[model samples]
Target: MTTKTSDSPLPWPPAAEQLPPHLRLMGIAAAKWVVQPVYVLAKLGAADHLAEEELSTAALADRLKVRCDPLRRCLRAAASVGIFRETEQDHWALTDTADHLRTDAQMSLRDFTVLLGEAPMWAPFGHIMDVMRQDTPAFDAVHGQPMYAHLAEDDELARTYHGAWSSLTEGVMRALTTAYDFSRFATIADLGGGDGTALRILLATHPQLRGILMDLSHSGEIHQGADRAFEERLRTVSGRLPDDVPPGADAYFLKNTLHCLSPDLVLQTLRRIRSEMTRPEQRLLIVEGVVQQGNGFDWSKLMDIEVMVNNGGREHSLEEWRTLLSQSGFRLTSAREVLHPQWLLEAEAA
Candidate 1:
């Protein structure tokens, strides 16, 4: 929900107090471009196609089956944000932002773009009103099913939706890998770990350690692993939590997944993990973006709204996470805010 600023005033629109007739009368129309152009280019696979070669507006429009004029404007807007580059004579190429969308790029976010634009993803916005009116999750109104069920039922959505986390969590994964030593934990369960992206990183570090990716059984091999030994230590398990924690798993990892639920629900998730702790030394490490206090962030605030509409959820303050874990009978063993700013909290069975 933390949106990229594209000439749009993010903190919110200015007060309509006073304005010259031309500008004031138009009033806050700038915010609309941020919403429209992003979806347009995202759907076009603009970056994916451009990865091979720069394309002129006419060619890009032809590839996407659209008219040239509006497409040119969309491309220009994205270029202003440095997502795409206007090379010369209207041709466009990829920048770091566009690099994320390529099919074979070291870092690809095609899935993220696809998920963000899909109806299951966008439909929640339509019911934001209902969420405000009834103080509940808007997903049911949007999909006629629980969010989890909807994700499970629609494979395309489930894959793309889950991959958005892959794109977003890559930063946190680096923070975690850099901040902690994984060699200590003999066995780990990456709870709700979609494609085992985190496990891939941890296994490579620990060498002797083994990991269980407990979520979608079909989270296809994340491309060809660069490290074969690490790939061997990692195993995929299709199932829910508690049951999914493989035998002898002394370590549990639940990232980004925790803050999406209410405190009571978090308690249940913790209790389930606690039930699987075979030894007193077993621990649960959760990585999530904590809702920081004091300074306000557009990401946290807008994500707060996103969670509310999608799951009746919100990111937690560190204290809120601690309380949630404590209520579920876990003791906070250590807490670290990774240098990247996304906080990682580790807890142990009390």
Candidate 2:
């Protein structure tokens, strides 16, 4: 079956800025609690079961083999957040937003929700203050290892982490491909392209373009199945950045990869990519969340905190991005906001 695709995300929740000062503060403080019920709903596969048919809380609880009262509360909490709806006194049905929570739904966030609630990802936030004080990532301080190293040691966590990213990439690729002209580049290399979701989309959209998927190591698993035709035009390479970059691509992509690295590492990676550009026409495209200025509501501002806590990385502003690119022997050519806060930054060797 052809899975549905979405180029844009669901609308953001109503802003709390309109509320009274005390109520806004209270809502801000209580916001963290909201994820708990949503996590429970995703963890329980409630959306999948609900997709079969709307059922009363008692019946749904029995079907899921969980306590009725707690399940009912979770359903109600989720409903309050627009994830579900209570049709009758106890009857519940999936909302349009809830449909994306289903495991089989295209670009499903079930694993992403699970990842958010998992201790490795969630527990670090509680120590954000400590992390800020020490200049160490909370994930490393709490887990005794870097996030990537920890993932390497835990198979289940690694699957969920990669799966969450892959699912997210599927949703974002449409916008990225649409915003940027990939047809200009004959062969594009996706550095740190996990599971080749972005490449698949690029190749599918621009039929004449070929792609190289380079990562730390190839997982040998193609998401959503790349047929023999796609395989004929795509090549997978196992390598790390600042050293193992594949040569001969017309353009290179570093989507959502640089933000996970330190400033020095980002420079090194970019310098290496700059050195690898044999032709003056070769370009480097970076896709990342660009943190906006001011205290206004920007998703990247919140994501900045998440990355700071989870890894020693950050979302960069437009000025910071230009400075970084200049320092790495590259010139920032263009930066377009393709998917809300996520920007497509095009650069070339200085």
Candidate 3:
């Protein structure tokens, strides 16, 4: 089946190849400190305050209850990166980029920013050397627990972590709904669908289709809104992957879930889904980024590093995808780019 192609614009911070060799390397080195200011701004909720009106640094600092001088410096650093703008002496306003940092923004990045800057997520990067030399994830080394397990113990952190994923998934779901045809499947199960974001988009897009959203027990509260909205057509199940797959759906989907798992786990998860397929016609759709084959810059390569550090998971190339699916008793039928770096791979029981 044919799907629409992406017209999305290229991401900012221009590609490394666009710059002179020396400057490119220098920019890469300087990038380490760039997120710090933005993180501080997000943590302070500066963008929310700025949304009402431009304010002097002193007033903004007072509202946020932080030291005026350091807050101003942080604002200046963020302004330098186009996140905010200094309108006049000591007065700052939100730039278009910074507006997305507001909590009420339709596409908010505030939680995602805070998540990346938080100690549990950021401190692990320092142990990347350990991840490389010893095979232990930097996150495990730093926190002595897996990322999800740590989140389980901290309710506030869990909210931020899941909220950040929900924010990130919203746009991806929009892209996916338009890029692939789901009308063919009368029912679809979103395995490990966090917060039911994808199912919300899919069911909204194709009115004829019903959906099952299966995630961990902790996601029950998160699914309440979706449950209320589409009460009749939607089913919410508390379950984990590589098992607990409910059967009898026309198709099953795993979006942004496999990459968070180890290879064996991924295989087991796929096999579990395969076992639940009662019909030969039942399909499986995997939505994730495929590592490109080139020396060129690709975002998936960068995400691969994050996955490695955080959970010992990984991004896969097309070859790797084929092998995994084959081992799990499915045949890859089509793989198309729905968004830059993200692909929609359709497979059927083999």
CA-lDDT, candidates in order = 0.72, 0.83, 0.84
Candidate 1 residue-wise lDDT at 139: 88
State the lDDT of candidate 1 residue by residue for 1-350, as single tens digits: 11222332322233345455556445456654554575678767777677677778999899989999999898877666556778669887776666777655565677776676677778788767787678568887767877877887888788777677776676677767878877788888888887777887677666778888877555645535456676677777677643445566878888877656766677787887777775887888988767767765546556777777887778887788888888888988888788444677888888
lDDT of 2 by residue, 179-245 (tens): 7787789999999887788898899999999999997553556544668899999988888766778
- Model 1: residues >4 Å from true position, as ranges? 1-32, 80-82, 85-88, 216-232, 241-247, 339-341
Model 1: how far residue 173 lies from native, Å: 1.9
Clashing pairs in 1: 100-109
Q: How big is the positional error of residue 256 in model 1, measured in Å on the Cα after superposition?
A: 0.9
How close to the true structure is residue 324 of candidate 3, measured as C-alpha lDDT?
Answer: 98
What is the lDDT, from 0 to 100, of the residue 158 in candidate 3?
82
**Which portions of model 3 show Cα errors greater than 4 Å?**
1-23, 226-229
Please give me the total number of clashing residue pairs in predicted model 2.
Answer: 0
Model 3 residue pairs with clashes = none
Please give the lDDT score for candidate 3: 0.84
Q: What are the per-model C-alpha RMSD values against the true structure?
A: 5.0, 3.7, 5.3
Candidate 1 lDDT at 25 equals 40
